[model samples]
Target: MTGFDSHLFEGRTVVVTGAGRGIGAAVAAAFLHCGASVIAHAGRDLSHAEGDLLSRVPSAARSRLVLLTEDLAAPDGGAQLADQVLARTGVIDVLVNNAGTMGGRIRAGEETAETYDHVLDLNIRSVVALTGCLLPALRASEQASIVNTVSISARAGGSAGSALYAGTKAFVSGWTKTLAKELAPDGIRVNAVSPGTIMTDFHRRYSTPEKLEATAAAIPLKRLGMADDCAPAYVFLAAGSLSGYVTGQVLEVNGGQLMP
Candidate 1:
């Protein structure tokens, strides 16, 4: 449904985590629209997909979408998802490590070991595990691209109670750069998409209406972002023809909220 070429990703295979709803679903749908066979990890359940993700794809493209449900926070969760992917295909043209969460806003002093582990496990550990497991498949492709989901909070030190989540994102940002350099030898490029305050369910749960309004006012664009606004960045980064020379970069889709 985007303005991108329908055949942009023809004959390619893409894997997207957290695709049941919000930004992840939008990203998955975008790739499908562009003609890629998509393996979408729909979080821990398919309930969200029935309404959110499934509604986005037309009936014609439904055949190209494969939905899987997994709890990426569980033990060896990433590897388990990778197993499902490998069973389906040996070559992955694009890997979008977009499954992550804030886990909720735990105040600095109020945090516990359990909370720390939960956030780290979901945001950092799972991504590393998934990407590691998929390396062989990625290397099989003539050109492979890895796109990670980072956040404005990574650099801006997000609002109070989000320190742990922000730290995890920052870690991924650094990892994305490191992997880009390390994987370049194999013709695989690694990059990340840092989204601004998008008006998705993520904000609905963590950000109050008043806070969202204030934040929107502060942005130069005078509004918050959307899942669709962030989807194009993933498509652009995944399409080698579009960003063949780009790597180790964090493309910001924050609507001028952070100029840097």
Candidate 2:
């Protein structure tokens, strides 16, 4: 159940999406440490060896790492990503849809169809299609889990920076609950992780210096979040023995940033 609890992921096969950097990269490292073979999937940007994520990872577990690239936002990309993993691993025990976008915001009148669609395409549509495509492979495993990376934007309303991004994540907030119910009977667990304002590239891009400091200062914990802090939640959900009864839950990793 915990990455610290046990090597629960021993011999498992996992995929870490948007894994070239930031949170996704951190997640891949955690899983690799737990004895799982990792498929490091990324969009166009984070692709190869040099500054690529897999390279930064030390050689300790490098043999378990398989670095690959695919743009999940484009048509057929999700299926292609799954297909690539299937071709090599032949089966997958977990799928982590961690790839996303967070660079746009517009009020109702100012929003464009293309912009909205782009966000939805990568954040929501890709998740759905990839989940469908990977079902067969996931089912073949003795235990399977799916973790959708969501955001505080999924429900919080105060952010002027996440107008459209939040809307797309709201779909994630609702869909993961429903998907969990639908997939439970298949012996697979589906859940979402809604992280608060972390110091990821996404946050760095959207937050001004003043805004960043203010947001961190306002948190009850007096600090922003980190990728390492959030990655273990995914590990727990993916470990059946540890989180066999956990499903359809959104585990928030923010530091008292959004309270219900």
> lDDT (CA) for every model shown?
0.95, 0.81
Clashes of 2: 1
**Candidate 2, poorest ten consecutive residues by summed lDDT:** 1-10
Local lDDT at 243 for model 1 = 99
Deviating ranges (above 4 Å) for candidate 2: 1-6, 47-52
Q: How many residue pairs clash in each candidate?
A: 0, 1
Question: Model 1: per-residue lDDT, tens digit, 118-210?
Answer: 899999999999999999999999989999999999999899899999999999999999999999999999999999999988999999999
Q: Residue 86, candidate 2: how far off, in angstroms?
A: 1.9
- What pairs collide in candidate 2? 1-242
RMSD of each: 0.6, 2.3
> What's each prediction's TM-score?
0.99, 0.93
lDDT score of residue 33 within candidate 2:
78
